[model samples]
Target: MHYVKSKSILSAKNGMNLYRGCTHGCIYCDSRSKIYNMNHEFEDVEVKENALELLKKELIKRPKAMIGTGAMTDPYIPAEKHLKFVRNSLELIYRYGFGFTCITKSDLVLRDLDLLEKINEKSKVVVQMTLTTADDELCSILEPNVCPTSRRFEVLKMLDEAGIATVVWLCPILPYINDTEENINSILDYCIEANVHGVLCFGMGLTLRDGNREYFYEKLDEHFPGLKARYIKEFGNDYSIPSHDEKRLMEIFKYRTSKAGILNDTNEIMSYLSEFPQKSVQSKLF
Candidate 1:
Protein backbone atom coordinates (compact mmCIF):
# COMPACT_ATOMS: atom_id res chain seq x y z
CA MET A 1 0.00 0.00 0.00
CA HIS A 2 1.09 3.58 -0.68
CA TYR A 3 0.18 6.89 0.90
CA VAL A 4 -0.83 10.19 -0.73
CA LYS A 5 -2.02 13.56 0.46
CA SER A 6 -5.58 14.35 -0.64
CA LYS A 7 -6.64 17.99 -0.83
CA SER A 8 -10.13 17.30 0.46
CA ILE A 9 -11.87 14.65 2.53
CA LEU A 10 -15.41 14.86 1.20
CA SER A 11 -16.95 15.02 -2.27
CA ALA A 12 -19.69 17.42 -3.38
CA LYS A 13 -22.15 14.58 -2.80
CA ASN A 14 -20.92 14.00 0.77
CA GLY A 15 -18.98 10.85 -0.20
CA MET A 16 -15.31 10.16 0.52
CA ASN A 17 -13.00 7.43 -0.72
CA LEU A 18 -10.16 7.07 1.79
CA TYR A 19 -8.22 4.85 -0.60
CA ARG A 20 -7.65 4.83 -4.36
CA GLY A 21 -7.19 1.13 -5.20
CA CYS A 22 -8.77 -1.92 -3.64
CA THR A 23 -7.17 -5.11 -2.27
CA HIS A 24 -10.31 -7.27 -2.21
CA GLY A 25 -9.50 -8.30 -5.80
CA CYS A 26 -13.02 -8.38 -7.18
CA ILE A 27 -12.38 -9.76 -10.67
CA TYR A 28 -15.11 -7.52 -12.07
CA CYS A 29 -14.04 -4.40 -10.16
CA ASP A 30 -14.76 -1.11 -11.96
CA SER A 31 -12.06 0.68 -9.97
CA ARG A 32 -9.59 -1.04 -12.30
CA SER A 33 -10.92 1.18 -15.08
CA LYS A 34 -8.29 3.62 -16.33
CA ILE A 35 -10.71 6.52 -16.36
CA TYR A 36 -10.30 6.96 -12.61
CA ASN A 37 -6.57 7.65 -13.28
CA MET A 38 -5.36 5.53 -10.40
CA ASN A 39 -1.59 5.98 -10.69
CA HIS A 40 -0.65 2.81 -8.81
CA GLU A 41 -1.42 -0.84 -9.47
CA PHE A 42 -4.94 -2.09 -8.77
CA GLU A 43 -3.91 -4.28 -5.84
CA ASP A 44 -1.32 -1.83 -4.58
CA VAL A 45 -3.71 -0.08 -2.22
CA GLU A 46 -3.11 3.64 -1.78
CA VAL A 47 -3.73 4.88 1.71
CA LYS A 48 -4.85 8.47 2.08
CA GLU A 49 -2.30 9.59 4.63
CA ASN A 50 -3.87 11.07 7.75
CA ALA A 51 -7.35 10.45 6.35
CA LEU A 52 -8.85 10.21 9.82
CA GLU A 53 -7.03 13.35 10.86
CA LEU A 54 -8.26 15.16 7.77
CA LEU A 55 -11.77 13.90 8.42
CA LYS A 56 -11.59 15.21 11.95
CA LYS A 57 -10.37 18.59 10.73
CA GLU A 58 -13.07 18.72 8.04
CA LEU A 59 -15.79 17.72 10.47
CA ILE A 60 -14.70 20.49 12.81
CA LYS A 61 -14.91 23.04 10.00
CA ARG A 62 -18.23 21.97 8.47
CA PRO A 63 -21.20 23.75 10.00
CA LYS A 64 -23.54 20.90 8.96
CA ALA A 65 -22.29 17.32 8.90
CA MET A 66 -23.05 14.60 6.33
CA ILE A 67 -20.04 12.40 5.56
CA GLY A 68 -19.79 9.07 3.72
CA THR A 69 -17.20 6.89 1.98
CA GLY A 70 -16.32 3.51 0.45
CA ALA A 71 -17.76 4.21 -3.01
CA MET A 72 -14.62 3.85 -5.12
CA THR A 73 -12.79 1.47 -2.81
CA ASP A 74 -13.81 -0.62 0.14
CA PRO A 75 -12.88 1.35 3.27
CA TYR A 76 -12.45 -1.92 5.19
CA ILE A 77 -9.85 -3.36 2.84
CA PRO A 78 -7.46 -5.74 4.60
CA ALA A 79 -5.12 -2.79 5.17
CA GLU A 80 -7.80 -1.37 7.44
CA LYS A 81 -7.32 -4.36 9.73
CA HIS A 82 -3.74 -3.28 10.36
CA LEU A 83 -3.95 0.51 9.97
CA LYS A 84 -7.31 0.80 11.74
CA PHE A 85 -7.89 4.01 9.80
CA VAL A 86 -11.51 3.22 8.95
CA ARG A 87 -12.29 2.38 12.55
CA ASN A 88 -10.69 5.58 13.71
CA SER A 89 -12.60 7.51 11.05
CA LEU A 90 -15.85 6.04 12.29
CA GLU A 91 -14.90 6.98 15.82
CA LEU A 92 -14.32 10.55 14.68
CA ILE A 93 -17.73 10.55 12.94
CA TYR A 94 -19.34 9.33 16.11
CA ARG A 95 -17.41 11.85 18.21
CA TYR A 96 -18.53 14.73 16.02
CA GLY A 97 -22.09 13.34 16.11
CA PHE A 98 -22.34 13.13 12.32
CA GLY A 99 -24.23 10.61 10.26
CA PHE A 100 -22.09 7.72 8.97
CA THR A 101 -22.41 5.25 6.10
CA CYS A 102 -20.29 2.91 3.95
CA ILE A 103 -20.33 0.39 1.11
CA THR A 104 -18.34 -2.81 1.60
CA LYS A 105 -18.24 -6.41 0.33
CA SER A 106 -16.26 -7.62 3.33
CA ASP A 107 -17.74 -8.78 6.59
CA LEU A 108 -14.88 -6.90 8.23
CA VAL A 109 -17.38 -4.14 8.85
CA LEU A 110 -18.76 -6.49 11.49
CA ARG A 111 -15.72 -5.63 13.58
CA ASP A 112 -17.08 -2.10 13.93
CA LEU A 113 -20.72 -3.11 14.40
CA ASP A 114 -20.63 -1.79 17.92
CA LEU A 115 -19.59 1.63 16.68
CA LEU A 116 -22.15 1.42 13.89
CA GLU A 117 -24.91 0.70 16.37
CA LYS A 118 -23.92 3.70 18.46
CA ILE A 119 -23.98 5.99 15.43
CA ASN A 120 -27.38 4.70 14.33
CA GLU A 121 -28.77 5.10 17.81
CA LYS A 122 -27.65 8.69 18.12
CA SER A 123 -27.85 9.78 14.48
CA LYS A 124 -27.67 7.67 11.28
CA VAL A 125 -25.54 4.89 9.85
CA VAL A 126 -26.37 2.87 6.75
CA VAL A 127 -24.43 -0.10 5.41
CA GLN A 128 -24.66 -1.10 1.74
CA MET A 129 -23.65 -4.58 0.57
CA THR A 130 -23.49 -5.61 -3.06
CA LEU A 131 -25.19 -8.93 -3.84
CA THR A 132 -24.67 -10.04 -7.43
CA THR A 133 -24.87 -13.80 -7.25
CA ALA A 134 -26.63 -16.17 -4.91
CA ASP A 135 -24.44 -19.15 -5.70
CA ASP A 136 -21.34 -19.21 -3.52
CA GLU A 137 -18.95 -20.76 -6.06
CA LEU A 138 -20.04 -18.43 -8.87
CA CYS A 139 -19.58 -15.57 -6.44
CA SER A 140 -15.97 -16.71 -6.11
CA ILE A 141 -15.55 -16.43 -9.88
CA LEU A 142 -17.15 -12.96 -10.14
CA GLU A 143 -15.90 -11.16 -7.03
CA PRO A 144 -13.02 -13.63 -6.41
CA ASN A 145 -11.57 -12.17 -3.22
CA VAL A 146 -14.44 -10.72 -1.22
CA CYS A 147 -16.74 -12.50 1.19
CA PRO A 148 -19.50 -14.66 -0.33
CA THR A 149 -22.99 -13.37 -1.14
CA SER A 150 -24.61 -15.53 1.49
CA ARG A 151 -22.52 -13.95 4.21
CA ARG A 152 -23.37 -10.50 2.87
CA PHE A 153 -27.06 -11.34 3.03
CA GLU A 154 -26.52 -12.59 6.53
CA VAL A 155 -24.90 -9.28 7.47
CA LEU A 156 -27.80 -7.38 5.93
CA LYS A 157 -30.32 -9.49 7.77
CA MET A 158 -28.39 -9.09 10.99
CA LEU A 159 -28.32 -5.33 10.60
CA ASP A 160 -32.05 -5.15 9.88
CA GLU A 161 -32.89 -7.36 12.87
CA ALA A 162 -30.77 -5.03 14.98
CA GLY A 163 -32.92 -2.06 13.93
CA ILE A 164 -30.10 -0.57 11.82
CA ALA A 165 -31.31 -0.11 8.23
CA THR A 166 -29.46 -1.56 5.23
CA VAL A 167 -29.50 -1.23 1.44
CA VAL A 168 -28.41 -3.65 -1.26
CA TRP A 169 -26.69 -2.61 -4.50
CA LEU A 170 -28.08 -5.29 -6.80
CA CYS A 171 -25.86 -4.59 -9.72
CA PRO A 172 -23.39 -5.58 -12.43
CA ILE A 173 -25.47 -8.46 -13.70
CA LEU A 174 -23.07 -9.40 -16.46
CA PRO A 175 -24.82 -10.33 -19.68
CA TYR A 176 -24.53 -13.96 -20.88
CA ILE A 177 -23.29 -14.48 -17.36
CA ASN A 178 -25.28 -14.03 -14.15
CA ASP A 179 -28.12 -12.12 -15.77
CA THR A 180 -30.83 -14.69 -15.45
CA GLU A 181 -34.21 -13.58 -14.15
CA GLU A 182 -33.97 -16.32 -11.56
CA ASN A 183 -30.76 -14.83 -10.20
CA ILE A 184 -32.31 -11.37 -9.93
CA ASN A 185 -35.39 -12.67 -8.19
CA SER A 186 -33.29 -14.74 -5.81
CA ILE A 187 -31.24 -11.71 -4.74
CA LEU A 188 -34.37 -9.60 -4.44
CA ASP A 189 -35.90 -12.38 -2.37
CA TYR A 190 -32.93 -12.24 -0.04
CA CYS A 191 -33.34 -8.47 0.31
CA ILE A 192 -36.96 -8.95 1.18
CA GLU A 193 -36.16 -11.71 3.64
CA ALA A 194 -33.62 -9.46 5.28
CA ASN A 195 -36.23 -6.73 5.51
CA VAL A 196 -33.76 -4.22 4.12
CA HIS A 197 -34.82 -0.61 3.83
CA GLY A 198 -34.21 -0.42 0.06
CA VAL A 199 -32.71 -1.95 -3.07
CA LEU A 200 -30.76 0.19 -5.56
CA CYS A 201 -30.67 -1.24 -9.08
CA PHE A 202 -30.77 1.17 -11.99
CA GLY A 203 -31.19 -1.67 -14.41
CA MET A 204 -30.54 -5.37 -14.73
CA GLY A 205 -27.30 -4.91 -16.68
CA LEU A 206 -23.56 -4.29 -16.43
CA THR A 207 -21.57 -1.27 -17.60
CA LEU A 208 -18.07 -2.02 -18.87
CA ARG A 209 -15.48 0.66 -19.57
CA ASP A 210 -11.87 0.54 -20.81
CA GLY A 211 -9.83 -1.01 -17.99
CA ASN A 212 -12.51 -3.11 -16.35
CA ARG A 213 -13.79 -4.22 -19.75
CA GLU A 214 -10.60 -5.98 -20.77
CA TYR A 215 -10.18 -7.53 -17.33
CA PHE A 216 -13.75 -8.80 -17.34
CA TYR A 217 -13.46 -10.24 -20.86
CA GLU A 218 -10.21 -12.00 -19.95
CA LYS A 219 -11.82 -13.47 -16.87
CA LEU A 220 -14.79 -14.54 -18.97
CA ASP A 221 -12.51 -16.47 -21.32
CA GLU A 222 -10.92 -18.20 -18.35
CA HIS A 223 -14.08 -19.00 -16.43
CA PHE A 224 -16.97 -19.31 -18.88
CA PRO A 225 -15.03 -19.83 -22.16
CA GLY A 226 -16.52 -18.52 -25.46
CA LEU A 227 -18.37 -15.87 -23.44
CA LYS A 228 -15.93 -13.11 -24.35
CA ALA A 229 -16.57 -13.71 -28.05
CA ARG A 230 -20.26 -13.51 -27.35
CA TYR A 231 -19.81 -10.20 -25.52
CA ILE A 232 -17.81 -8.82 -28.44
CA LYS A 233 -20.44 -9.94 -30.93
CA GLU A 234 -23.18 -8.41 -28.83
CA PHE A 235 -21.90 -5.33 -27.07
CA GLY A 236 -18.94 -4.40 -29.32
CA ASN A 237 -17.51 -1.24 -27.75
CA ASP A 238 -20.86 -0.07 -26.43
CA TYR A 239 -20.89 0.59 -22.70
CA SER A 240 -24.10 -0.92 -21.37
CA ILE A 241 -24.63 -4.67 -21.59
CA PRO A 242 -28.26 -5.19 -20.89
CA SER A 243 -29.22 -8.79 -20.34
CA HIS A 244 -31.84 -10.41 -22.59
CA ASP A 245 -33.94 -10.78 -19.48
CA GLU A 246 -33.64 -7.22 -18.18
CA LYS A 247 -37.31 -6.39 -18.48
CA ARG A 248 -38.46 -9.54 -16.70
CA LEU A 249 -35.88 -9.19 -13.91
CA MET A 250 -36.75 -5.54 -13.39
CA GLU A 251 -40.42 -6.41 -13.12
CA ILE A 252 -39.60 -8.99 -10.47
CA PHE A 253 -37.46 -6.49 -8.56
CA LYS A 254 -40.31 -3.99 -8.65
CA TYR A 255 -42.94 -6.51 -7.58
CA ARG A 256 -40.83 -8.05 -4.82
CA THR A 257 -39.63 -4.81 -3.26
CA SER A 258 -43.03 -3.21 -3.58
CA LYS A 259 -44.61 -6.11 -1.74
CA ALA A 260 -41.84 -5.98 0.86
CA GLY A 261 -42.33 -2.24 1.29
CA ILE A 262 -38.70 -1.66 0.31
CA LEU A 263 -37.62 1.21 -1.89
CA ASN A 264 -36.73 -0.41 -5.22
CA ASP A 265 -35.80 2.40 -7.60
CA THR A 266 -32.42 4.11 -7.77
CA ASN A 267 -33.88 7.58 -7.27
CA GLU A 268 -35.81 6.51 -4.19
CA ILE A 269 -32.90 4.59 -2.73
CA MET A 270 -30.48 7.49 -3.30
CA SER A 271 -32.91 9.94 -1.83
CA TYR A 272 -33.21 7.72 1.22
CA LEU A 273 -29.44 7.58 1.54
CA SER A 274 -28.89 11.31 1.06
CA GLU A 275 -31.81 12.37 3.20
CA PHE A 276 -30.88 13.77 6.58
CA PRO A 277 -33.62 12.61 8.90
CA GLN A 278 -35.86 15.30 10.36
CA LYS A 279 -35.25 13.74 13.79
CA SER A 280 -31.52 14.50 13.51
CA VAL A 281 -32.23 18.01 12.30
CA GLN A 282 -34.54 18.68 15.21
CA SER A 283 -32.15 17.28 17.80
CA LYS A 284 -29.05 18.96 16.39
CA LEU A 285 -30.85 22.28 16.02
CA PHE A 286 -32.45 22.61 19.47
Candidate 2:
Protein backbone atom coordinates (compact mmCIF):
# COMPACT_ATOMS: atom_id res chain seq x y z
CA MET A 1 0.00 0.00 0.00
CA HIS A 2 1.11 3.56 -0.79
CA TYR A 3 -0.30 7.06 -0.28
CA VAL A 4 -0.72 10.03 -2.59
CA LYS A 5 -2.57 13.30 -2.18
CA SER A 6 -5.30 13.68 -4.78
CA LYS A 7 -6.16 17.09 -6.23
CA SER A 8 -9.87 16.37 -5.93
CA ILE A 9 -11.97 13.86 -4.09
CA LEU A 10 -15.42 13.92 -5.66
CA SER A 11 -16.39 13.67 -9.31
CA ALA A 12 -18.94 15.90 -11.03
CA LYS A 13 -21.62 13.30 -10.29
CA ASN A 14 -20.55 13.15 -6.61
CA GLY A 15 -18.68 9.87 -6.95
CA MET A 16 -15.50 9.49 -4.86
CA ASN A 17 -12.92 6.73 -5.12
CA LEU A 18 -10.82 6.48 -1.93
CA TYR A 19 -8.28 4.23 -3.61
CA ARG A 20 -6.83 4.11 -7.08
CA GLY A 21 -5.84 0.43 -7.53
CA CYS A 22 -7.20 -2.90 -6.26
CA THR A 23 -6.17 -6.17 -4.62
CA HIS A 24 -9.33 -8.32 -4.76
CA GLY A 25 -7.76 -10.02 -7.81
CA CYS A 26 -10.95 -10.43 -9.82
CA ILE A 27 -9.98 -12.00 -13.12
CA TYR A 28 -12.04 -9.57 -15.26
CA CYS A 29 -11.46 -6.16 -13.61
CA ASP A 30 -11.99 -3.43 -16.21
CA SER A 31 -10.19 -0.87 -14.08
CA ARG A 32 -7.05 -2.49 -15.45
CA SER A 33 -8.04 -1.14 -18.86
CA LYS A 34 -5.43 1.21 -20.27
CA ILE A 35 -7.84 4.11 -20.52
CA TYR A 36 -7.89 4.68 -16.73
CA ASN A 37 -4.10 5.29 -16.96
CA MET A 38 -3.26 3.73 -13.63
CA ASN A 39 0.50 4.17 -13.35
CA HIS A 40 1.11 1.75 -10.50
CA GLU A 41 0.81 -2.00 -10.51
CA PHE A 42 -2.80 -3.14 -10.42
CA GLU A 43 -2.37 -4.97 -7.11
CA ASP A 44 -0.41 -2.16 -5.47
CA VAL A 45 -3.20 -0.23 -3.76
CA GLU A 46 -2.96 3.58 -3.93
CA VAL A 47 -4.43 5.43 -1.00
CA LYS A 48 -5.73 8.97 -1.40
CA GLU A 49 -4.11 10.41 1.70
CA ASN A 50 -6.13 13.64 1.77
CA ALA A 51 -9.44 12.20 0.63
CA LEU A 52 -11.27 12.65 3.93
CA GLU A 53 -10.47 16.33 4.37
CA LEU A 54 -11.25 16.94 0.72
CA LEU A 55 -14.50 15.00 1.02
CA LYS A 56 -15.58 16.99 4.04
CA LYS A 57 -14.93 20.26 2.22
CA GLU A 58 -16.80 19.12 -0.89
CA LEU A 59 -19.75 17.79 1.11
CA ILE A 60 -20.14 21.09 2.92
CA LYS A 61 -20.40 23.01 -0.33
CA ARG A 62 -22.68 20.66 -2.21
CA PRO A 63 -26.42 20.27 -1.83
CA LYS A 64 -27.73 17.01 -0.44
CA ALA A 65 -26.99 14.31 -3.01
CA MET A 66 -25.84 10.74 -2.96
CA ILE A 67 -22.03 10.38 -2.65
CA GLY A 68 -20.90 7.25 -4.47
CA THR A 69 -17.68 5.31 -4.05
CA GLY A 70 -16.16 2.07 -5.34
CA ALA A 71 -16.87 2.83 -8.97
CA MET A 72 -13.23 2.37 -9.96
CA THR A 73 -12.04 0.57 -6.87
CA ASP A 74 -13.84 -1.34 -4.12
CA PRO A 75 -13.88 0.78 -0.96
CA TYR A 76 -13.96 -2.26 1.32
CA ILE A 77 -10.60 -3.72 0.28
CA PRO A 78 -8.52 -5.33 3.06
CA ALA A 79 -6.60 -2.06 3.58
CA GLU A 80 -9.87 -0.52 4.80
CA LYS A 81 -9.77 -2.76 7.86
CA HIS A 82 -6.85 -0.83 9.34
CA LEU A 83 -6.89 2.47 7.44
CA LYS A 84 -10.60 2.97 8.19
CA PHE A 85 -10.84 5.35 5.19
CA VAL A 86 -14.28 4.15 4.14
CA ARG A 87 -15.61 4.02 7.68
CA ASN A 88 -14.20 7.48 8.40
CA SER A 89 -15.66 8.87 5.18
CA LEU A 90 -19.05 7.44 6.12
CA GLU A 91 -18.84 9.29 9.43
CA LEU A 92 -18.10 12.50 7.54
CA ILE A 93 -21.02 11.95 5.17
CA TYR A 94 -23.29 11.28 8.14
CA ARG A 95 -22.00 14.28 10.05
CA TYR A 96 -22.73 16.55 7.10
CA GLY A 97 -26.16 14.93 6.52
CA PHE A 98 -25.29 13.68 3.05
CA GLY A 99 -26.46 10.46 1.39
CA PHE A 100 -24.06 7.57 0.72
CA THR A 101 -23.75 4.71 -1.76
CA CYS A 102 -20.97 2.31 -2.67
CA ILE A 103 -20.21 -0.70 -4.86
CA THR A 104 -18.15 -3.53 -3.44
CA LYS A 105 -17.51 -7.30 -3.65
CA SER A 106 -16.42 -7.73 -0.02
CA ASP A 107 -18.23 -8.67 3.16
CA LEU A 108 -16.04 -6.20 5.07
CA VAL A 109 -18.97 -3.92 4.40
CA LEU A 110 -20.62 -5.73 7.30
CA ARG A 111 -18.17 -3.96 9.62
CA ASP A 112 -19.70 -0.56 8.85
CA LEU A 113 -23.32 -1.65 8.91
CA ASP A 114 -23.89 0.74 11.80
CA LEU A 115 -22.71 3.77 9.78
CA LEU A 116 -24.73 2.66 6.78
CA GLU A 117 -27.87 2.40 8.91
CA LYS A 118 -27.17 5.80 10.46
CA ILE A 119 -26.70 7.42 7.04
CA ASN A 120 -29.89 5.76 5.80
CA GLU A 121 -31.81 7.32 8.66
CA LYS A 122 -30.44 10.76 7.83
CA SER A 123 -30.68 10.53 4.02
CA LYS A 124 -30.26 7.30 2.07
CA VAL A 125 -27.73 4.53 1.65
CA VAL A 126 -27.58 2.11 -1.22
CA VAL A 127 -25.01 -0.69 -1.22
CA GLN A 128 -24.30 -2.41 -4.50
CA MET A 129 -22.55 -5.77 -4.57
CA THR A 130 -21.29 -7.67 -7.61
CA LEU A 131 -22.34 -11.31 -7.88
CA THR A 132 -21.02 -13.04 -11.00
CA THR A 133 -21.41 -16.71 -10.18
CA ALA A 134 -23.66 -18.63 -7.81
CA ASP A 135 -21.25 -21.47 -7.18
CA ASP A 136 -18.83 -20.67 -4.37
CA GLU A 137 -16.13 -22.78 -6.03
CA LEU A 138 -16.42 -20.87 -9.27
CA CYS A 139 -16.55 -17.62 -7.32
CA SER A 140 -13.28 -18.56 -5.69
CA ILE A 141 -11.63 -18.98 -9.08
CA LEU A 142 -13.14 -15.87 -10.68
CA GLU A 143 -12.89 -13.40 -7.81
CA PRO A 144 -10.09 -15.16 -5.87
CA ASN A 145 -9.27 -12.80 -2.96
CA VAL A 146 -12.63 -11.61 -1.67
CA CYS A 147 -15.57 -13.36 -0.08
CA PRO A 148 -17.73 -15.54 -2.33
CA THR A 149 -21.16 -14.81 -3.81
CA SER A 150 -22.88 -16.73 -1.03
CA ARG A 151 -21.42 -14.41 1.57
CA ARG A 152 -22.29 -11.36 -0.52
CA PHE A 153 -25.86 -12.71 -0.67
CA GLU A 154 -25.81 -12.89 3.12
CA VAL A 155 -24.64 -9.26 3.27
CA LEU A 156 -27.46 -8.16 0.96
CA LYS A 157 -30.06 -9.87 3.15
CA MET A 158 -28.63 -8.23 6.24
CA LEU A 159 -28.72 -4.82 4.54
CA ASP A 160 -32.35 -5.40 3.52
CA GLU A 161 -33.28 -6.38 7.08
CA ALA A 162 -31.72 -3.11 8.22
CA GLY A 163 -33.99 -1.29 5.74
CA ILE A 164 -31.03 -0.14 3.63
CA ALA A 165 -31.59 -0.47 -0.13
CA THR A 166 -29.26 -2.84 -1.99
CA VAL A 167 -28.46 -3.58 -5.62
CA VAL A 168 -26.68 -6.44 -7.33
CA TRP A 169 -24.33 -6.04 -10.33
CA LEU A 170 -24.68 -9.32 -12.22
CA CYS A 171 -22.08 -8.82 -14.86
CA PRO A 172 -18.79 -9.67 -16.68
CA ILE A 173 -20.39 -12.98 -17.60
CA LEU A 174 -17.45 -14.94 -19.09
CA PRO A 175 -18.45 -16.51 -22.40
CA TYR A 176 -18.27 -20.28 -22.01
CA ILE A 177 -17.45 -20.33 -18.33
CA ASN A 178 -20.41 -18.77 -16.49
CA ASP A 179 -22.77 -17.80 -19.29
CA THR A 180 -25.01 -20.79 -18.64
CA GLU A 181 -28.72 -20.61 -17.86
CA GLU A 182 -28.25 -22.45 -14.57
CA ASN A 183 -25.68 -19.92 -13.34
CA ILE A 184 -27.92 -17.02 -14.19
CA ASN A 185 -30.91 -18.66 -12.52
CA SER A 186 -28.98 -19.49 -9.36
CA ILE A 187 -27.64 -15.94 -9.03
CA LEU A 188 -31.07 -14.47 -9.63
CA ASP A 189 -32.46 -16.79 -6.96
CA TYR A 190 -29.98 -15.29 -4.50
CA CYS A 191 -31.05 -11.76 -5.51
CA ILE A 192 -34.71 -12.63 -5.05
CA GLU A 193 -33.99 -14.29 -1.71
CA ALA A 194 -31.98 -11.24 -0.59
CA ASN A 195 -34.75 -8.91 -1.70
CA VAL A 196 -32.39 -6.60 -3.58
CA HIS A 197 -33.83 -3.39 -5.02
CA GLY A 198 -32.40 -4.21 -8.49
CA VAL A 199 -29.98 -6.25 -10.56
CA LEU A 200 -27.81 -4.41 -13.13
CA CYS A 201 -26.49 -6.39 -16.09
CA PHE A 202 -25.39 -4.54 -19.21
CA GLY A 203 -25.24 -7.75 -21.22
CA MET A 204 -24.36 -11.42 -20.95
CA GLY A 205 -20.63 -11.01 -21.65
CA LEU A 206 -17.61 -9.11 -20.34
CA THR A 207 -15.95 -6.14 -22.06
CA LEU A 208 -12.27 -6.61 -22.77
CA ARG A 209 -10.06 -3.64 -23.56
CA ASP A 210 -6.32 -3.64 -24.15
CA GLY A 211 -4.96 -3.98 -20.58
CA ASN A 212 -7.75 -6.11 -19.09
CA ARG A 213 -7.96 -8.38 -22.09
CA GLU A 214 -4.31 -9.34 -21.74
CA TYR A 215 -4.65 -9.93 -17.98
CA PHE A 216 -7.87 -11.92 -18.37
CA TYR A 217 -6.37 -14.07 -21.08
CA GLU A 218 -3.32 -14.72 -18.90
CA LYS A 219 -5.56 -15.89 -16.09
CA LEU A 220 -7.45 -18.08 -18.51
CA ASP A 221 -4.21 -19.69 -19.56
CA GLU A 222 -3.31 -20.30 -15.93
CA HIS A 223 -6.66 -21.91 -15.04
CA PHE A 224 -8.42 -22.95 -18.24
CA PRO A 225 -5.76 -24.03 -20.68
CA GLY A 226 -6.37 -23.29 -24.39
CA LEU A 227 -9.28 -21.03 -23.36
CA LYS A 228 -7.25 -17.94 -24.27
CA ALA A 229 -6.79 -19.21 -27.80
CA ARG A 230 -10.50 -19.94 -27.94
CA TYR A 231 -11.30 -16.41 -26.79
CA ILE A 232 -8.87 -14.95 -29.31
CA LYS A 233 -10.48 -16.96 -32.10
CA GLU A 234 -14.02 -16.11 -31.04
CA PHE A 235 -13.34 -12.46 -30.27
CA GLY A 236 -10.49 -11.01 -32.29
CA ASN A 237 -9.62 -7.58 -30.88
CA ASP A 238 -13.27 -6.96 -30.11
CA TYR A 239 -14.18 -4.66 -27.25
CA SER A 240 -17.62 -6.12 -26.49
CA ILE A 241 -17.50 -9.90 -26.19
CA PRO A 242 -21.08 -11.14 -26.11
CA SER A 243 -21.81 -14.66 -25.03
CA HIS A 244 -23.54 -17.06 -27.43
CA ASP A 245 -26.25 -17.47 -24.79
CA GLU A 246 -26.72 -13.72 -24.19
CA LYS A 247 -30.26 -13.78 -25.49
CA ARG A 248 -31.31 -16.87 -23.55
CA LEU A 249 -29.63 -15.83 -20.31
CA MET A 250 -31.04 -12.31 -20.61
CA GLU A 251 -34.48 -13.83 -20.98
CA ILE A 252 -33.92 -15.74 -17.75
CA PHE A 253 -32.60 -12.59 -16.05
CA LYS A 254 -35.60 -10.49 -17.08
CA TYR A 255 -38.14 -13.20 -16.28
CA ARG A 256 -36.70 -13.95 -12.83
CA THR A 257 -36.24 -10.29 -11.75
CA SER A 258 -39.66 -9.35 -13.08
CA LYS A 259 -41.31 -12.17 -11.16
CA ALA A 260 -39.45 -11.05 -8.03
CA GLY A 261 -40.45 -7.39 -8.62
CA ILE A 262 -36.84 -6.19 -8.55
CA LEU A 263 -35.80 -3.20 -10.63
CA ASN A 264 -34.46 -4.43 -13.96
CA ASP A 265 -34.08 -1.13 -15.76
CA THR A 266 -30.53 0.31 -15.64
CA ASN A 267 -31.68 3.93 -15.91
CA GLU A 268 -34.16 3.59 -13.07
CA ILE A 269 -31.65 1.87 -10.82
CA MET A 270 -29.00 4.54 -11.50
CA SER A 271 -31.50 7.27 -10.73
CA TYR A 272 -32.32 5.52 -7.49
CA LEU A 273 -28.65 5.41 -6.58
CA SER A 274 -28.08 9.11 -7.28
CA GLU A 275 -31.34 10.40 -5.79
CA PHE A 276 -31.28 11.86 -2.29
CA PRO A 277 -34.35 11.83 -0.09
CA GLN A 278 -35.60 15.42 -0.29
CA LYS A 279 -37.17 15.01 3.10
CA SER A 280 -33.73 14.47 4.62
CA VAL A 281 -32.50 17.72 3.15
CA GLN A 282 -35.63 19.56 4.29
CA SER A 283 -35.26 18.23 7.79
CA LYS A 284 -31.71 19.58 7.93
CA LEU A 285 -32.73 23.03 6.61
CA PHE A 286 -35.48 23.55 9.20
Candidate 1, residues 1-286: lDDT per residue as tens digits? 8889878878767788888898776767888888999778899988889777778888887745556787899888888888888888889888888888788888998999999999888788889888999989999988888889999988898888778889889988888778887788789889889988888887988888999999888888889989888889988988888888889888888888898899887887787787765462344554
Per-residue CA lDDT of candidate 2, range 61-132, in tens?
A: 998899999999999999999999999999999999999999999999999999999999988999999999
Worst 10 residues of 1 by lDDT: 277-286
Q: lDDT, candidate 2, residue 174?
A: 96
Candidate 1 overall Cα lDDT vs. reference?
A: 0.84
Model 1 — TM-score against the truth? Answer: 0.95
Clashing pairs in 1: none
TM-score of each candidate structure, all chains considered together: 0.95, 0.97
Misplaced by over 4 Å in model 1 are: 280-286
Error of 1 at 129 (Å): 0.7
- Whole-model lDDT, model 2: 0.94
